[model samples]
Target: MSTALLVIDMLNRYEHDDAGALAESVGESVPNIRRLLDAARQQDSTVVYVNDNHGEWTADRRELADWALQGSRPDLVEPILPSPDVPLLVKARHSAFYATQLDYFLRTHNVDRIVLTGQVTEQCILYSALDAYVRHFDVAVPSDAVAHIHKDLSDAALAMMERNMRARVCLTDELVGVFGSR
Candidate 1:
């Protein structure tokens, strides 16, 4: 399957109101996300960093990384920072496809399936999965790779995606095998 791994909102500086809480929650998921990234690289799957631009329209990947490194938890951004060759799409909204070239980019690369990973599982992950489903791209969300601000909402969101969007609500190891298979 032609697949892409979308890493969302992990480049955050944690400067918002719920930044600390969100950071702490997402911290546990970082290692899982890193595992997914490493597997994606080994499998030759497309790795895209779809980050929230943090309202800095002029900011590029380097600028965003620099800003994030100065935040309370620089370690959060260190492990998962996109390499220079990896495509980084700066999004202004929650859904990565909203007003962004993500759809076209995926199509251009012939990506029919997407593995979603990153922070705020109830927000960006949920919305992005909906958008991906409506756009006809198969969605796979590893439960352990996504961080959430709210437990109840996160569980509800995952259920909604699995039941409604038909997303594969599996674990990171399972997804790694799938991505690595022919």
Candidate 2:
């Protein structure tokens, strides 16, 4: 399968990214995200950062990030920036499928399966997975790599995805095998 790692809503925004929850386990997910990133590297898979483009009103995604960080919307999120190598996709709505070029990029890259990792599982993460499933992409969520408004809701979302959408709710440790490295 052509798998891609989708890091969603890890931007500096409260509505989607976990502003309050970061003091808890969100930092813990970073190492795993990094690990998953390395795994994707070995597998020659795509790494896409699906960020909330508070660009919902005006401007574009980069402008949104700049405004959120440099402007008065500091309460929404803290800066959890991605690496330079990671490709970014600005999502105007909850799901990454909302008027975004995610579909086009996936098609161009021949990405058939997606390994989703990001913040606010109850919202952006869940919505993205649902849309991916609907689009007939194999969806997998590494439980340790995502959190929700609360950890409880995170677990619940994962359960729902596994039971309803038939997604694989995996662990970061299990992600090692997906890499093509020998």
Candidate 3:
């Protein structure tokens, strides 16, 4: 079963401080997510940046990046994920599947399993993962690769994924172990 990485809400508006709305929540997971993304790229796996439109119809990604760099958003997304060259950017409001071509992309790519990793585990990630699962796609989330405002929320989100959605809520170290047999 092939897997696609759904990076939800790792956008400039959320991660970057300039966009400012308490989204400064995501921490160190940036590098961890980058590592997994790089691995997916190397393996020829799909890397979908499922981000929020921030309801900015006229918002240019470049403008957002510049504003983020201007120091308004200390923790804003850097050049790592939100790049203009990445042809796989899907903008959304709540769920990544909300009016986004994400489901189409997954179907087109023949992806059955989805590896979810991003910010606000209780909100965006939670909804996206559940949506994917409800659509009959396999879902897995690396515990450390997801960051919430609090650990309890993160844990609860993972619990919902495991209990309700039947997703594999794993830690980074356990991922290799879980995938190594294949």
Candidate 4:
């Protein structure tokens, strides 16, 4: 089965109310995410980025990344920036698949399984996992690669993903093993 890595909502301005806490978690997860990106690319796994548009409807991937670079925590976003060649989908809501073309994109690419990584684990990551599950795609989420604003909620969310959604919740290295390496 072909696997695609979905990097969700990592591009942020950090101007929201709980930005500091979220940024802290994202800081810790960035290295793992970077490693996942490198490993996925090296292994020939498809890599796609799904981000919040921030209402910049006209902004392309480069423009979105550039705008995010101007945020307070550009350091966190820099290491995991989506490459120009990677497909970037902008979402308006918490779930990446909600009102987005992600499902169609994955279908077109023949991606039967997906590795989800990025911010707000309790929110976007969890919702995306459910959406993916309902779409009949096997979902895998690397715990170390997802950032969350609230630890307790994220823990519960992860549990739900594994239990209800049947997602594989593992560490970055373990997920890389599942993906296989060159």
lDDT of each: 0.91, 0.75, 0.70, 0.91
lDDT of 3 by residue, 33-74 (tens): 777767776676766777665666665666545544554444
How many collisions per candidate? 0, 1, 6, 0
Tens-place lDDT digits, model 1, residues 13-84: 788888877888888899999998998899888999999988899999899999888888888989999999
User: How high is the lDDT of residue 124 in model 2?
Assistant: 82
Ranking by lDDT: 4, 1, 2, 3
Evaluate residue 162 in candidate 2 and report its C-alpha lDDT on the 0 to 100 scale.
Answer: 96
- Badly placed stretches (over 4 Å) of model 2 are 13-18, 56-80, 179-182
Write candidate 4's Cα lDDT for 5-80 as tens digits.
9999999888899999999999889999999898888887888999999998999888999999998989998998
Q: Model 2 clash tally?
A: 1
- Tens-digit per-residue lDDT, 118-164, candidate 2: 77687888888899999998889998887666877778889899998
Model 1 pairs in collision? none
Ranking by TM-score: 1, 4, 3, 2
